[model samples]
Target chain A: MNGLLIAIKSETFIALRTFASKLIVAAPALVAAAQLLLVRLTEAGQQARDSLLGGSNFEADVANNAYGFFVDSLSTGLTMLGLLLVAQAAYSYSYERDIGSIRHILIRRVSRRSLLSAKLIHLHVLALLSVLLLLVSSYLLSGMLWEYSAIVEDGFELISESEIREEITLGIQLALLPLPAAIAFGLLISVSAQSATQAVSTALGITLAIDIFKGLLGGSGPLSLCEFPAFPDRPVLFTIRQSHSARLFRCIDR
Target chain B: MQALSVTGLNKKYGSFAVLDDLNLQIDKGSIHGLVGLNGSGKTTTIECILGLQEFNSGSITALGYPPPQLHLSKGRLVAIFDSPSLHPNLTVRQCLEHALLLCEKPKRSTEDVETLLGISRFRDFKIKNLSLGNKRRASIAQALLGDPEFIVLDEPFNGLDAEGVDDVLELIRTLNRDQGTTFLLCSHQLPYLEQICSHIAILHKGKISHSDTINNLLGNTQTILQLKTAETEAASKVLETISGAELIDIDTDGYLNIRISGADSIAINQAMVENKIPVAELILKRASLAGLFREITSEDA
Candidate 1:
């Protein structure tokens, strides 16, 4: 851990000035916000057509709940964040090595292990910031587009807003929990790969390939890709789906 | 005390050995040069010393620290690579600033180094945008951010204009003379290295075949006298009688190629005259850095 602080400061200095760090922090939120806006616009057009045709929507209340939309947005944003973090983590070290900048730090003020650890910490900080921003934007956008209310029928509440909030919080926690491990895997690839392009492509390709193939294994199979600690997005995907389905079922019960 | 030392170093790629029991020593305040032909393991040696590439077996200590723990030196040692190892996205000013952050006690400001390296106009330019020479300057600028006690440079003069070469040479001279900085410069530019380096290590095959002070090593090299004559047999006979002259070979044309070690060329010429060997032509060729390197490496082969 020698020169860890200096390495971190160097990392932070570059991250602050470079495009990659900013992309990691802002891209997920931007993508999620766009998705939410597009969904809202499409819903508005559908409602306009419904009114013109004089047809009534029966499941409108459930669809209009902000909590469900918020949960959905979190899922999409986290998915993007997960993939982005892995790709970025893979790129960071290998790119520096490719450019030969890492040699200076190694020779002057940082050990190899310290350099790697500093990168890990720096990427984690970036991932955390991205998740926070995504959460805030998603929450704000969903609230703006939909009502914050409990699922109710005949003036009797079937599911309380507080209960829905608890489920969404749990879902968010489970979905976001595997990100650090995913980033570590990306870093391992970064260290092992020869070039930045190879590192990034291998990291994302292996991660996504594993995720895609793991579905063929399915739950209760010998090789559960969803349960793989390194590839945690599958469980996260399941959590997002479960959250949405729970809210949908509450509305059906009402 | 030595500023850097490598002992019994061995490096290999698959079965081919790049370095075999290689040893080098750079004394404090001396500009040491590592000169060899291409693919003669100059870069490999540098990389092994800096911990950029691992050696199979050896011990390397720089500034009282092993290669793996070189960071413990904390800005006291630095290196400038052959390639411009700067952040391409960062402007020259920003790259310098980032390097400055790593310095424990900054001696020169980024502006100071920028102006010193004559890269002030390109300060705002990204490293990727700067020409190779300017990028090299910026890379050198970063190494000068602190008052490093030791500096290692690999192929330092590559892609530089004549002026750039002069500037870098002068910079190395000044640093060693004024600051008592130790240097380990690796390059094939023997004449430039001969101009600046106090000591030269000739890496041949996989080991240091010859290493000493530049004066001593060149002093030990044999001078050649290409003796053209009407009588090659007579010249050969006369050269055999000389104490320090050895007839190494006879060329296609009737000429006696002789090596004079610890002996004067005049003595051989005088011997030929006394023996009545008609010397048609006599050319004196003194051994040089290039000559010695070529001789030693050619011998190794």
Candidate 2:
């Protein structure tokens, strides 16, 4: 049990302090920011229609508006979670070896099986935390901006409450479905790797290949969404919003 | 019961034989010294004894049980390598904690072990930041943690200062006296081993060239007597009356050194007392491991 704890702590430390964690957080936030910028440019025609038109109106457009901010936030959150698994699972085995901790561990009475299990558990926990952080950060950032716009528009109302809940729920599923595969593939790569560099390189390459192949074989015959676990044939964003205006509102709430 | 036993153990690496028909036995409650020149397969033998390496032939038994069945013996046995095998990043406290976790119950205090090794100051320092001597102290502390029934230490005093060496020597003596811990120590430091070990085994070319109890090995080998002679004639006369003593060489300073082959201390005293050749100094010297080693090895070479 002590050995298991040590292994878990080691993984947690690496995930929290390493470059991988930063990338997981940054990639999705950047995507959301770019989407907000593009929406603001397209919405200049709607400025007359929007009573909340102002210098910082883009943030308000998504923030008070449920669908636009929600979808944007959800996509960013799921991508960050996937990236965490991609980074951690890929480098798990080889990292310990490169750091020379493998010698110390193997010499102890702990079995290799327990060590591997502990690593997997640690990785999963970190993945969950990363996902949580991404979701919370995007929601809060979009919420603040949307609330500001609602206040300036003479009232704090922009989108309905039902649409807001639906967008958030759909976002969570979109981020969650790929979790098991990420963990399994990470374990496979980590076990097969002899060093950290090799593990990271191999896992990343394999993840890229699998993702590309999954995309290519996505709609082909038996390889359709029905064959995948919790696979989505159509984007969940479309179902999340009832109308085009609602879709924009949902994306902003995300 | 024998603490450790290895019989006809054979091993090879890529057609090069490392250990060929090697056999060794260490009795319980005995401090055994293993001495060998460089590349004499000492480390390999130690590794094989610890079950770290797979031997091709023969078997090893610890505490009367074969290695495969020696699971219980593992906790009872501990080994200290020639090099300081420690994680450089961990502090001494962390290192001991990790080692103690691996050991069975009846926990020992890390404080006690640290004080015993005189490394309390290094308890919080990372192993990498420590001096070589302190690193050895930490290693020794780890070995002493479980207070195992048997221990194998390889060149333990290599990097220790005199004071540190004495502390270790005293600890080993105390453990041996109080708990009867069987020890198999391999070192080229003959004087240090001579001070503590009861039995000695010298390995040469993957085989034990010589092995015997320290007292027996010393008492059985010939002793060299260095005597200062006032008169060469008188010294020669005095030497002729001594039985079982051969004069090896005489210096220009009138020093007569003769080899006495047996444990007859009284015969030499009587002869010298009778001769009364103005005896300046009468010293009986035992053959050291170094002299014996050079003679045995060069003769073979």
Candidate 3:
């Protein structure tokens, strides 16, 4: 127990002073904010063209809902976060080993098992912080760009605000289930690989390969066990929006 | 008390033996030097002792703990490796502060070690930006933060300049004298080891061929006295009369090389003059660690 604590302290000391840890925590949030800004600019341009042509805004209610954009931004941020966590976890152990710094802690106060456990715990903490920031930034930016309300048509509510919130919540829960598994896979590669470069490249490569395999199987088969959490093809919110949008279009035709 | 002991240790890699039935014992509060050639298993032995790697069969103990359990000693054991094993991105001060986290009770502050190692000016410099010698200085500085009972240094003098070497040697002496700290240094620099080590162990062919105090090992080899004279036969006859001198051979340089055990050069030269032999040049070559090491290693070669 004492050895483990010392190892944690040592890991924290280096993490606080290093750049890689900061990169892992902040990069996802920054990228996600940039993505949301770009998306809003594109939407504004489209709205201008439609107004100039005097086109009918039949789908404007659904399109203008901030929930959809929030979910999209969350997906983008989560995808980047997942990759960053894996790469950082893979780099942490192997880089210390390559530099021979791990030997000092091993000989002085920490066992091999304790050192590895501390790293695992430290990476998980970074993941948690990154997720919190991603949630906050994406929620705030999406709300600023559009209104958070229900989908309505001609003074009659088609979808309630509570229903939209429920779908978005379900979609986010499904997207976050696979993150811990990703972090564990990265640590496993870190200990087994020979060098830091080899560990990172191999971990990222195997993760991407699994993602590709998951796609080829059409989200079915044993490959789904290692599914990429972000950017799911049919999130609950997207499915609900599509179903309602199609119903409204049919009503207009009638 | 023995600080470290390795008995009948055998380590083999894919049927190739790296260390075969090796045995060594280092007493507490003594600086022991392990010297060997490039391919010798010096580094491997240190790694196995530190529990960084496993050996096939061995019984090793350090500071009342096995290699795997050395960490339980709570910073009683430290090691400075050949390469500077520090984070390149961190400043020297930051690296020391990180090391302090592993120490159960640090004895010296970061500033103290930096000043002791003459690296106070480079405290804020990143390890990667420092010169190799300064990087090595920083590496040594971190090890001194804890009050270690036993320290292991591999190639401690590899990248140091002459002044840096002097500082390290002085530091080792001061620590050993003041705190009674033991050290096991593995290096190829024979002269530096001779200067600092109280005992020397020559690792040859996967085993310790010789292990003894410096005086005892060098005492086994006889000093050579070279004499140059126009009358080689007359000089040879006079040297035969000396009790402790045995004429080995007259080398191609026309100098009679005699191995003397107890006879001094003055006595030999005085006897040569009394015998009416005009000695042009008389040179006495004392036995050194290098000479004794050569004599031992060359025997098998």
Segments in model 2 whose C-alpha atoms lie over 4 Å from true places: A1-254, B64-74, B226-241, B249-257, B263-284
The local lDDT score (0 to 100) that residue B3 gets in candidate 1 is: 97
Measured against the native two-chain assembly using Cα atoms, what DockQ does each of the candidate structures obtain, in the order listed? 0.78, 0.12, 0.85
lDDT of each residue in B53-88, candidate 1, tens digit only:
988998999988988888889889999999999989
Q: Write the per-residue lDDT of candidate 2 for residues B1-301, one digit (tens) a residue.
A: 8898888888888798877888788999999998887888888888777655678898888776565433344357777777677766678988787667556553468998898888898898988899989988988788777758888888889899999999989988999999999999988888888899999887877677677898877766667887775666777776777677778888776677788875354676667677775667777766876666666667778
Shift of residue A67 alpha carbon in model 1, Å: 2.4
lDDT of 3 by residue, A1-254 (tens): 88888888888888899898898889888988998899889988988998898866547657777776777677667777788878888898899999999999999989999998998889888888988998898889889998888767788887787876776676566567668777888889999999999999998988777656655675253334325533234332233334434443232211
**Ranked by TM-score, top first:** 3, 1, 2
> By TM-score, how accurate is candidate 1?
0.90
Error of 1 at A56 (Å): 2.9
DockQ-based ranking, best first? 3, 1, 2
Total clashes for model 1: 0
Tens digits of per-residue lDDT for model 2 on A1-254?
Answer: 66566555545544554466566546655666565556555654466556554465545545546345546555544544555576677676666555444433443333455568777787666666666666666666656544422212335554456655654575456446567667667777777787767777776676556444666663362333222222223332333333334543533543
Q: Which candidate achieves the best DockQ against the true structure? A: 3
